[model samples]
Target chain A: MTFVIMFLEFFKTGLFAIGGGLATLPFLYDMAAKYPWFNEAILSDMIAISESTPGPIGINMATYAGYHVGSQYFGIPGGIFGAILTTTALVLPSLIVILIIAKFLERFKTNQFVKDAFYGLRPAVTALIAYAGYQVVAESLFRFSTFFETMQIGDLFVWNAIILFIVLMVLSRVFKKIHPAAWIGIAAVVGILLKF
Target chain B: MRLLWDLFFTFFRIGGLTFGGGYAMLPMLQNELVEKRKWTTEEELLDYYAVGQCTPGIIAVNTATFVGQKIKGFWGAVFATAGVVFPSLVIISIIAGFIQNFSHLEWVQHAFAGIRVAVAVLVVNAVLKLWKSGIKDILGIIIFIVTFVVSAVFSLSPVFVVIAAILVGILAGQVKRRTKK
Candidate 1:
């Protein structure tokens, strides 16, 4: 029963989460609020892992979330099952839609309606991704969860995080050709070595 | 049989090599599918991306599916999609298992803290690239700003925002056509 619901939820995400991988962040945020499977903190981990790993971020996340949810209910085997279930659910909608579109590929590509809709969608999708980027920054760098209780402005910022973010941003620009996984590996080493 | 296996392996390589996000897979795809394998042309690949953008699904998965369909029909799409996601299943599952077991440790938490910052930088970079490519005109600027405010501040559902954008785009296109006439 839980598995069925999991499949359905991710299936909905796959069906409606248009644009790209980051575009699915909003829906995942909603899921975090509604379900006990994962939380905002885990979502950040998902982003980190998904970004640094192979394959598309969206599919990786779906598999990760599925494993988390499934493991909670069952054991390790259940987690693997959940991963397959959710991954399949996420990909099913895309396969069906793309297959249909492929059948009439030329017509769909040249359609004025499709073109016009995408014109507006492109900017909106950009905004959606930008907003998602802000969420990651705020969640990781701000002490929002404790702000109301303490109410101290100085205590609001995670300075270590801020410093690291600035450093990484500069390094990324300077080392433009470096793979993201390498940066992540470096950050992990720095974190452990410096006790960040 | 050989062609199907080839599709699977090619996409598997693509799925395994790229990092960061879906868009990051583009260069890898061009190298393997277009330049190396000669499976798709540059323009056709762009069209796949465009269609993949508007359609419902992850862009990378959709592109793989389209490329697969173009090559060997239904089974090709199936193998390609499966191959693309295979690495994520294996890699993430192993990491998730370890992370769950050791997540309570101080050092692990510290590592995640630093990793989170890295994730933020990558996301910000992705946003900048999207802005460069997607935002073109005054109307686009307006839509971008409005969508950001509502979704971020008000926490509106993204589904509603996407639907509204499609309607507005079509309406604006119609109005432009009439004015030109």
Candidate 2:
């Protein structure tokens, strides 16, 4: 059951997350809401981990989500199996669609309906990515549960982390084209140095 | 046999190097596929990016599939797809092992905190870049705002929001055509 559900959810995500991996963020948040297998925090962790690691972001996330969820129900083997199943299901749509398009992209490339659909979709995807970014920052910089429970500013925010965020933002503006991996490495080192 | 290996090796290296996401693979694709291997031209690469964007899966995988099929048909597509995702699967599996063991440690916890903040910044920059590429004019802006608010709202399902955006886009496109006439 875990395997089937994992396969199906990711298959749907693969189908509908049209723009790219970041575009998949909304669907993932919904999945966290819908399933008890994982929660919002883990989802953020997945995004961070997925962003840092190699391979495709969407595929890495689906694999991580599937493994974590499946392990709870079955075992480690079940988790690994679920990961394999999910990765396959997630890419199946692209394989089919790309094959079809490779054959006839010439005709469809200039299609009006396609153009309009994409035009509208591009902005929407941008918005979705923005929403995703907001979620990531919120998770990174604040302790929401603590804030809600205590209703105090000190409880609500982690000033040290917030400082790191602002400093990173400044560095980003200065070195606009440095590889993201380098930035991630520097942050990890600083986090260790500061003892977080 | 060698052709499949070539496809796999090329994409495997590509899959390993790209950090940000599918879009980050663009220059690497240009260098390897066109300048290095002659698998695709610059124009064809752009076409793949555009088509890949609107397609139903990860853009990088879709682009790989397109390039693979063009080179060696269905099997070529398989090899390329496998290659691109192969490194991620391997590396992430190892990370999963370490994370399970060390996630609760003091230093690991702190490092992740820093990494998360850095990732947040990266995502913000990505949004800004997307803005320059995709959002222009009033209609695009309207679509962006509506989609952002609706999807960001906890109560609203993102599925409906995406569907609404597509429908409105099609309508707006049709109206713009009529106005031009």
Candidate 3:
């Protein structure tokens, strides 16, 4: 049952979450809302781990989610099977869609309708990504629910988290050559020192 | 056999080195696939990206599928997709099996605390780059703002947003063409 649900949910995600990897966030968050086995914090970990490691972010995340969710129901073998199912299901849509497009690439690649659609789609993808970044912000440094619930100033923000955010933002703009993984390493060190 | 192996290894190497998302693999793909092997050209690669963006699934996988189909037909697509995915399956299984459960430890928790913040910044940087390239005219700005607001506040389904955007784009193009005459 867990395996079947995982396959279907990820298949939906694969079919709908267009505009690339980061765009998968809202769908993943939706799954968390519906399931007890997943949580926002772990989703954040998925983003971090999936980003740093090899391969596509969406595939890595789907596999991670599948393994975790399946493990709860059937342990190790379920974990492995879940990973395979989720991955295959997630990429299946792309396999079909791309093959169709590639079949017509010579004739339709530069079609006017296609160009117009992309003209609109590209900007929307930009906004979608911005929304994804906004989500990362809300999930990471700001807990608006807690801030409202406690009605406390201290709960308003994670100061250290924001500081790290700002510093990295500034450094990225200035340095322009610092490797992305190095930034993660720095954040991990800062987190340990501040006891975040 | 050799074709499959080459497709697998080529994409496997790309899968291994790329750090962020599908887009991050662009430069490396250009270097390896275009410059080194001449499997595809710069123009074709960009087209693949555009098509991949409009298609379902990760752009990386979609791009791979298109390239594989172009080069080696059905099996090429299979080998390429499998190659790219092969790395993540192994690495993530290891993490999910062990480290992910213990990720609740205080130090690990704190590490993610800061890691998320940094990652947020990286995602923002990616958006900025996309904005520079994607958004241009008035219609583009309107679409961007509306989608961002809807997504941030209401958390609307992204599928709905993308579908509507496609319609708007088609209509806007029609209007522009008529006005030009």
What are the per-model DockQ values?
Answer: 0.49, 0.45, 0.50
Taking the tens digit of each residue's C-alpha lDDT, what string does model 3 give over A137-179?
8888787988899999889898878888898999978975555
Sort the candidates on lDDT, descending order.
Answer: 1, 3, 2
Tens digit of per-residue lDDT, candidate 2, span A46-159: 776765565677888777776676667677876777677788889998899899888775467688886776677677767766776788889889999999999897998889
Q: Better model by DockQ, 1 or 3?
A: 3
Best by TM-score: 3
| Clash pairs for candidate 2 | none
Chain A TM-score, structure 2:
0.58
TM-score of chain A of each: 0.58, 0.58, 0.59
Model 3 C-alpha lDDT per residue in residues B78-172, reported as the tens digit of each score: 99988888788888988899875454467776776776677677767766656766888999999999988888788575677877988999999
DockQ of 1: 0.49
> What would the per-residue lDDT of candidate 2 be over residues B71-166, giving only the tens digit for each residue?
999999999998998887767766664575335567766776777777777777766756776787898898889888877766464455566767
Whose lDDT is higher: candidate 2's or candidate 3's?
Answer: 3
What range of 10 consecutive residues in model 3 chain A has the weakest lDDT sum?
Answer: A175-184
